[model samples]
Target: MLEKIKNNFNTQTWVLIPIAIAINIAIGQLVLVLKLPVFLDSIGTVLVAVLCGPWAGALTGALSNTIWGIAIDPSAFPWWPVAAMIGYMAGRMAQWGFFKSWWKVVVTGFVVAITAAIVSTPIAVYLFGGITASGSSFITAYLLQTGQGIWSAVVSTSFLTEPVDKITTAMLAFAIVQGLPRRTIGGYPKPEQVEVEGGEGEGGANNTQMYIAIGVVVLLVLFAAFMLRNILGG
Candidate 1:
């Protein structure tokens, strides 16, 4: 296990971690400032997970939130576990070959989102009382006001918010990896994890997959909006 973990780190992996952390903080802070319901913070974390390894991804996620909390936003401190688990789950899914194509990347993202929701539920409940500083807390607050249990409210909020953010993050990361030159991507610990399985020389498959992914994203957005309207209106 130690060897497996050790194999994930290389000169390139080390270089990428700080860059990933920076990306996480910059985008995360921007989302906070904009007060967007979806957090686009984990794009970098997913990037590292697909390229490097789960441990490296976890480190990037944890450090990303830690630095963001200490230097930029204090509220980000308590959510490091959620971020760490996102990274870990993304990397594990990648290792299992889920990052190979755009549709597979979507699956990876959904799995990571579910993992994040489960890991975050306790923190949101016990630490923040089902209301963190996140924009999604508004949903949780509404649920609570409607007499929903704290845990249920928080989990529901996570289910609604995390999939959109995480799926987007995973797709974006997959696009970035797909755009990279073969030689450039080869330096990563898990380059095979992102290989376009069907046909490399041909371009049609990638485009089709991307289009399908976009359609899925649109449907998810509509579904989330409908759910929010119904829950808040009812």
Candidate 2:
């Protein structure tokens, strides 16, 4: 087990971790600045997981949140465990061959999102009284006002919001991997994990996947708008 874990790391993996962490932080802050409902922060975590390995991915996620928390907001510090689990789950999904095709990647995202929801619920309940600083906590606040318990309110909010963010994160990461040159990808520790399984080299299929990812993002934006309207309008 130790050897297996160690094998996931190399010079390339080490080089990728800081880059991944930076991506997480930059995108996270971007979303916050734009007041986007979805976090969209874990793209780097999933990317590292697919290209390197779970442990490396987890380290990226943990450090990403930790550094961001210290540098930006102390509130983000408590959520490092949730970020770590997102990385671990994404890496495990890739190991299970779930990151190859667009559909499988969606499933991987859904699974990771569920894992994140589960991991974050307790923290939100005990730490923040189910009222996180996140915009999604408005949903939780609504649910709580409807007579739901803290756990239920938090979990429901996560369930409703996490899938869209995580699925998009996974899809975007897959697209990034697809767009990279083969030689550049080869430097990663587990490049084989991201190799397109069949003849997706055809331009048409690649375009379709890109469109699908874009479509998903557009739909998510619309849904977020709708949700925000209802949440605030109430």
Candidate 3:
């Protein structure tokens, strides 16, 4: 296991981690500033997971959240495990060939989101009394007021918020990987993990897939908005 984990890191992977961490922190802070409902913070984490490996991805996620917490907000310090799992799961999905196409990438994103939700629940429940500083915690607070258990409220909030953000993050990461030069990508530890499934010749099909991914993200955003409306309107 250690050997497998070690193989995921090369000089390029090492170099990528810090950049990925910066991306995570910058986007996360931007979302916080904008009061966005979704946290698009894990794009870099998923990118590293797909391009490097699970271990490296996990490291990037952990460090990203840690640095963000230390330098920006103390509240973020406790969620490093959730961030790490996001990276780890994204990497595992890529290793399993899920990163090779737009639809599979969506699946990867959903899985990562679920992992994040599950991992974050305990932290939210125990560390912060089922309410953190995030906007999503409003959902948890409302659920608690309605007499839901703390775990249920936190988990429900996570379920409501995680999928859309994570799926979007994965798709964006995929787009970034597609946009990068082949030579630059080749320097990464697992460059082949991100090779488009149908090859570049299938441009039309790839375009269709991209559209589907975009449509899904739009739908998820609308769903989240609807949920927020219901929660607030209630």
Among these predicted structures, which one has the highest TM-score? 1
Cα deviation at 52, candidate 3, in Å, is 0.7
- What C-alpha lDDT do the candidate models reach, one value each? 0.88, 0.85, 0.89
Off by over 4 Å in 3: 32-35, 199-205, 229-234
Query: What is candidate 1's CA lDDT for residue 88?
Result: 92
By lDDT, the best candidate is: 3
Q: How would you encode candidate 2's per-residue C-alpha lDDT over 8-35 as one tens digit per residue?
A: 7999988888898889888888887998
| lDDT (tens digit, per residue) of candidate 3 on 172-226 | 8998999899999999889989887664685422888889888988898889889
Reference-based TM-score of each model: 0.94, 0.89, 0.93
Q: What is the Cα root-mean-square deviation between model 1 and the actual structure?
A: 1.7
Residue 16 CA displacement from its true place in model 3, Å: 0.8
In terms of lDDT, model 2 sits at 0.85
Q: Clashing pairs in model 3?
A: none
| lDDT of model 1, residue 44 | 91
Q: Which is better, 2 or 3, measured by TM-score?
A: 3
84: Cα error in model 1, Å:
0.7
Q: State each model's C-alpha RMSD to the native.
A: 1.7, 2.5, 1.8
